[model samples]
Target: METVAITPLDTAAGAEQSHDPLRRQQAVVALGRRAVAAPDSEILLHDAAALIADMVGTDRFLVAESDPNGGQLTLQLVTRQRYGGNKPLVHHVALDGAQSLAGYVLQVGHPVAAEHLAADRRFQDRFLSRHGIQSALAVPLCLPHRSFGALAACSSHERIFDAGDLLFAETVAHVVTTAVARCRVEQALATERRLSAGMLQTVGAIVLVLDARGQIVHINEACQRLTGFSLDEIRRRPVWDVLPVAEELDLFKSIFDGLRHGLGPVQFESCLLTKHSERRRVAWTYNTVCDAQGEIESILATGIDITEQQKRQQPEETPDANTPAGNPPSEPEERNRQHPNAADSRKVPVRRPSPINVERRSRPRRSYPYRQSIAPVQDGELPDPAEFYQVQCNDIAAGGFSFLSPRPPESASIVVALGTPPSLTYLHAQIAHVTRMRKEGKWVYLVGCSYTGRAFY
Candidate 1:
């Protein structure tokens, strides 16, 4: 039997040659080598089928793969010369276990060779007649310890594919099985790496990585925008050197201590020194990012700017009127009255009522409580001590009245005129509740004096 590699035949001749034995085994080995050397499975399938077709003088080839569970075979690639043109047609058939040569190969592990399928009775001929195929060859593509389906070649002519063709087809089939398995593994690994990178890029919060010496090692896009500094410039720069010296040293110490003690996600407020020469108060959450061996590789931090928040929480200071322009002022009038002096007593003396009048006023009488009233305070003006008014009284509690004053006075001294307002004004009076006024808008300062021999209301 002549080898297909050296057989002499017409270019268009095709007839069943199943009984013809293999003559050029070396040529079939070369085809298997080419399939393995191809970069991917698709190329391996295409070249493997083409090589066998050339040696057998056949025109159609179908490469199939076995299912992972060993229950079925899948037709992966099919090649044919359509309309006898120079361009060949390739079809990717779907995997089906019902109506194809791949399905038959999966059920029967041996090869199938048919010469004139329309008359052959050993195999199902109806499927071959439907596809206009007259002769066919199906060889199993097997790997070590696994079956990877079969290679099926057919011809439109009455006869083709001999023993030598099936041998070459089986060799290429084995190589395609190995190539497909390897490609699937590499692709899965590449997909996992891409997904990991995508997750890191979209992580929430401003991620900043700093080295042990307080130098920036890495920063995400959010951190870069917040600090107004390019990552390149901030990298390897100390954190404290960037901030102002006025801040407390305890804040920096706490940050480093928390990181060193294996504490997770420490939170604290501090000032962030910006590239534009501005200091921004910020609250930071930090954690130590460690390597696979549990050693700290860098410090990971998240920061929130709180300068405006701190300013809003502070209270305003009270102003003074005694100071000249550009100089710090002295205390106000209310504060000055808290101190005592001899001249204050020489200004106003205590007031006393007659004993006979006090006895008559104290006589029992059923009547409504006497309504005491306070005077209104002058706007933007402090009251003079000399303007205080009084009436003679024995029941001092009922004599208590209200007076209007803005911002309660710091202190009050009750002076008694022993005889009369103009003549005995130089006498001194007993002191009363110093500052019992409610502190609010233009309110009254209520002062009650202790007049020992005074009359009742």
Candidate 2:
């Protein structure tokens, strides 16, 4: 192996071309392959530095990267020949500047050479004096978007760097620029893939990705929780085998048939068997995943567990005639009071209708005065109501209340304000019933709502 020259190229004009052209071509070819084979930006930079040092006949090399905002140049790699030895010593350096030799090359967007750095007036930096450098060559690593940085080779002896030396350094810089660009693109693509996977895993609903053959390619955490099966155990299994349906088979069959014919997106309800042999009802919406050629490649299924919701909608059993339902009235006369100013009617002989009517009337009711407001409760935050409606509150109890309005509210659930005005308490209530009635030739809506939890009041 021919040792690189430490003497300045200015003094030895033909030193760079002294080697056979064929040998130089072979070396360049080898260096290009090595630069491309490196896996990441750091490795590529280290290899490029070593190759440039060997080709240029110098043991000292430095690779600096420019900051994206054009504020500074970061020295990423540094290599120096050991004293009295041919083997190079390499270490990372944190030196950075906007007015250094490397920075000048980057700023000028061209190659730069200095025969005597101590006396060079174009740029001033303490690096050359501290490192005992007398001669240096630098070339910018240019890319389409911006210049990445500069590649530099330095010498301890005072000797000039020629055009051939600078040209060779430029060639190496080109290779490094290409490698850096490739690594950045690959890293960006990897980040995108990670983000996509994380979003799927973190979603709240049960999500499944199925191949055209109906095999379960992927399932999210919610799916695993719903089926009581681990991803490792259920992956690559047929969807029908993994998620057996106990009822509504026709609904699922139709969904599957539509997916086969590319008829989705379709939604339906069906029961799914869990790993522990328990069945859960779910409402699912499915769509097709297509490839670049527009052909259906896979199916994506998203579903919500409706088992609890369905149970909540079921009607409660009727209480027997002898059984007392709900809490007794705080006072007997308070049951049908209807208004705050009404006189006590407990002593009056009221006509008793039926046992059912007596049980229904037992619920206590309190008059809610005017200007009471209601809004929807969301995530512990109260948003302004789109429109406020004055209600004639019929009565209120610990468990529920009824109010009269001209029309029903948009949502079935709302946050109701109770107690006296200005120092009121809010409670979340769900609409339990709605009745249409006519009073004095005017249409009226009797809205009944039940408190969801303990009353805030």
Q: Distance (Å) between predicted and true CA of 281, model 1?
A: 26
How far is 134's C-alpha from truth in model 2 (Å)? 1.0
Best by TM-score: 2
lDDT by residue (tens digit), candidate 1, 305-383: 6566657554211111111111111333422342222123211111111233233222132221222222212331333
Per-residue error at 122 for model 1, in Å?
7.0
| TM agreement with the true structure for every prediction | 0.34, 0.40
How would you encode candidate 2's per-residue C-alpha lDDT over 408-434 as one tens digit per residue? Answer: 344445667665656556655555544
- Which portions of model 1 miss their true places by more than 4 Å? 1-23, 64-98, 119-128, 142-149, 160-162, 193-457
lDDT for each candidate structure: 0.47, 0.60
Candidate 1 lands at a TM-score of 0.34
